[model samples]
Target: MPNYWGPFAQLKEQTNAILEVANYNGLMAELNDALFIDRSDIAYYVDLAKEAGGPILELGCGSGRVTLPLLSGGYHVTGVDNSQDMLDILSKRMQHRSREEQSRLTMCREDARNFQLGNAFSLVIFPYCSLLLFTDPADRKSILKSVRRHLTSSGLFAFDAPVQESLNQERIFELDLPIESGKTVVTLGIKTYHEQKVMLENSLFQVAKSTNKRYTILEYKKLALFAEGELEQELQEAGFYVYKRIPTLSDNGKTLRYLYVCGKSDTDTYPLWHPYMPHNQLPNHVLTLVSGQGCRVTDQHGKTYIDASGGLWSVQCGLGNTYIIDAITKQLSTLSYGTLFAGRGNEPALALARKLVELAPYPLEWVYLTGSGSESVELSIKLARQFWHFAGLANKNRIVYLDQSYHGTFFGSMGVSGLYPAKETVGPGLPGLDCINAPNPDNCPPNQDYETYALTCAEQLETVARLKSDQIAAFIIEPVLGSAGVVIPPQAYFDRIAEICQRHNILLIVDEIATGFGRTGAWFCSTHFGIKPDIMLLSKGITSGYLPLGATLFSAEIGNRLLAHGAGIMHGSSHNGNPACCVAALATIDVLTNQQLIKRAREAGHYVRELLEQMKNEQPNVSGIRSLGLMAGVALCQNDHKPATKEQVAVIYELLKRKGVLAYPAVSSVVFFPALTITDDELQTVVQKLGEVLSSVQLVNNGTRMR
Candidate 1:
């Protein structure tokens, strides 16, 4: 009655009807019998522990989510859970298994918040949002203190909790409450307020199937939502220091859940504006290019702005090109879409694979196709792991990435990507990823040339390899840092990284999702950097952003190994290798080669760099400028020599929007990614408008006048 039980009491009552009508206890028992007890979570944690070489303890191991599989994997697992019902289920499951499995599992019935077993654990886990169950601040503090005590000196405590914003939103709790079977009427409820530290009230409504029975009710008292800062402060207060708060999903830049890694002494904080930040303040608009001729596009608004940013930095042949449109139209007429599974393949899929192989720098002979950049990155990691298993290097399963690099949005990609802001809203991602600091040639130690900075960054890769050694299976990086302020490394940076991977027997993967298809003045950024990675990931510009298409190109050696082991890769999607998307990519490549757009990109990039340099010199507020082809970053500095203030950057961005120019601020800078084929006159118009915006905006620094 006092709301002490939180949402669980409501959940029980709401489910009572289903239980009473359907023999709930019997159904639950049957479910327990036939459930097969999914051990994937356990297998995952076990694999992580094995890789980390740890004696691990899993807290809140409800229904043996991570305990049973760890036992099956032959890892010594000590599982702790507060619920006797869940532990009873796990005990029954273990009893049915062989003696060998039962030997590896140890169970303790105790509250995770204050339990201690008199032994230190190398890895401690609080899985499945179990930490969020502690609504009281004191209880949460006690849990963190207990975890710290249980962890060894160098142990890591990994846990997950629903993000505060995720809980504040109405959708998460707005589930449809079921009704009698006659009409299957249901009610959807949403939490609206919180009171008295534990009381949460919600608004509810009901709708009937086949009949109109809709109503709204003010439902009261549900759950507590903790802000991001509150969670961090609590952890810090309890003797635990958080290093990473990894997001669960990062598609359009919002994450609902977070996976936090904390340790006793691992107190490290990074610059807050990583890719996973959920601040959607940028004024983004889609310009519908209704018609075009050659490399020009006429938008529906009748105002053409040279298709800069290339429709998310992909359109290499410009927009509304006849060649690509015709190819796509033809493909839709012939075979719009088809499944590539079960040895069945389409002409477009095969032809596209061959084309990628032909164009790849090294002996990349095989291709795996997907629908987007995220899918491509996921497939690359899966393939790398599979290859390691096939080659009998079971211990080699870790992925290494660079900080501030944009990989993709899938769970695995989110784990490997270094953009924290983009993933902040999304909660806990796949585990077993290591991120190293990326090279910033423009902002590195003063007096060091870009080339020297590149070399130093490449050496960091060797440092990671030496530290992790045989545990690392692959190293993935973008040839030029794309999402993190469009930072570009020196020419020799990627080349040296490739050499280091070769020396360490770690597969090198290059993500060219944004920079491929002439976005970086070449067919691929890897080509411009003069490095041939063992695996090449491509999307975006592949289809000129007309359709979603991503491909993972593998070297001949890895391809042959996979082929010899099996007929095809194990993973796929419903829209994998869509014929229409394939045709779009093929047409896009054809346009780039036949129209010489890649060459245009190189020349245009040089021109844009010169213009930006002129602007930087003229505008004192301009801190630094870096450009590679159409991708550029114009960093604005504050009077205090710090990064530009959000308000200042926002003013400049809004001014550009009003002046018919479109660009977004990245970190402490504005990203300028115009289409590759803009004419000289059109390019001048963009710069002139930008100059006008800067001139009008008041700045913190005096004598830094915009002309």
Candidate 2:
């Protein structure tokens, strides 16, 4: 039997036509007609270039579809192609243009895989399936590495490649492919399939009839189909930060393509956010704790662990509070659901909004409700972009986030999150989001002072803005670093970060999802840092674990801007502002304020930390203990100064669970997040259980067990 993969492989080798016949103008025309390029796509690319602020370079510019338009729009563009014929065509096109337009166009003939321009560009584009040419993984990695070296410190690199599923099936030959004016008789023959690289080679025969004469042309094309995790790994290996992967404008499943936008790593700035773990993982243990009076929870298993982590770091009044339960029950009986679109209003939502505005820091008057933290983050991005449009800075749409920060996991939010591992499996996400290093007091670089580290980390925001000035719409962060091991920053960190955002006119979005509603013993974590952000992301604690809800609290300035412009922010989830959820939040807030759980959380956190510290001192396996309010991380030490293995950590975790103390193991450390309303006795018991587990833990090194 003839090998089908062999034919495609041979076809790609034979089709080496110089793309010179396709000029920039011709390419644009093809894109406009063939690819369905519209005003929105143009606007998005233009804004991307503006934010990217590049002396731009287009790798594999083949006929200049994107480069020419950008040049015509007054952007400095350098078009690179290995084929001299293509560059000749570009040169001719540039010469035909006016002198001013010609000045912005530069052409270079070089292999994209190894090309270097001796300098970096603010933006580098590999448009129109150009990335498909590199069938070798090493070549792709090499091209990305070279591209990374050619990018300005804060510049962006954008490209599009075919999706794996789109080309996974066997290629079929079509007799005639419809085209404008006439039908082009076309024949496609797959010659080879390189399964390792997911690349296929195919021969295309175009037979066009003109003046009743048949003209035939045979072209060999290499179609490289990128799997979900492949491109990201290559980009990472090449030193480019993979920021976004947007779906292709063309919805044809057969030609699935994604737009990848990346940039160079700069200094750490925004809070590192966590990517969303898929729902398929272990079901979130929802312990319906029955409680009353103050904040307390007893699980159905008849085991009660003081709420330390504060139900998902929210649940300010702890769990099973009567007021919140009653409020939710009452609201459910009346109006359970309502939409918040097109001027639609619900009484409970309005009341909750009003109450949030009253209690929010720094005149946060505009309230946007979401179903979860991820949704809230997405809304915040939309609001920032919309605000920029409203303020006539439509070009500023890039957002910056911190490294290792844990934001809600959604496609848009995941693009901004720094936890690469969680997002690695998921396919391409949104574009134009940037990340910087975050201040980690626990893991500060040796010899660097905390103040210096904080300033240096915070200043990365300004650096990113200056590098990509006029393009940044907002800087989002969490007041206290959560998820990437709860690494708290110095007191001056957030204050300086706020100042940097102020200096750059960038909207500062504080993700208080895990730190708000008295999680840090203050109404919001920002209060602990003595700073107020332009927007506050509140969730988890708002309803004290009774309902699912999140809020994007906006400042009066932004609210007035939106209202004055009559701009209705068209972003919300279906379950947004659920009446029952809102009522739960309202009642939870009442309980938190009336019963003073925030104060208690503060006092309890102090006591818990002291106990954890004493336990650490007595236990050999316990290395470090850090706490902020009710949130805490216990770092397990190794016997011989080696890092604790996952299996070792798992063993410790199993031991703790067996002792009836439930805790989460994060990477190499065990997280101790009990409820805020945990009694002093319960706190001691947790400390004792943790200590017992550590003391009994058998240290195994090199297959030998040690006491």
Query: RMSD to native for every prediction?
Result: 25.5, 24.7
Give candidate 2's TM-score.
0.57
Give the winner by TM-score: 1
Point out where model 2 deviates above 4 Å: 1-307, 420-422, 640-650, 698-706
Worst-scoring 10-residue span by lDDT in model 2: 279-288
Tens digits of per-residue lDDT for model 2, 514-534: 888877788877777777788
- In candidate 1, residue 697 scores what lDDT? 48
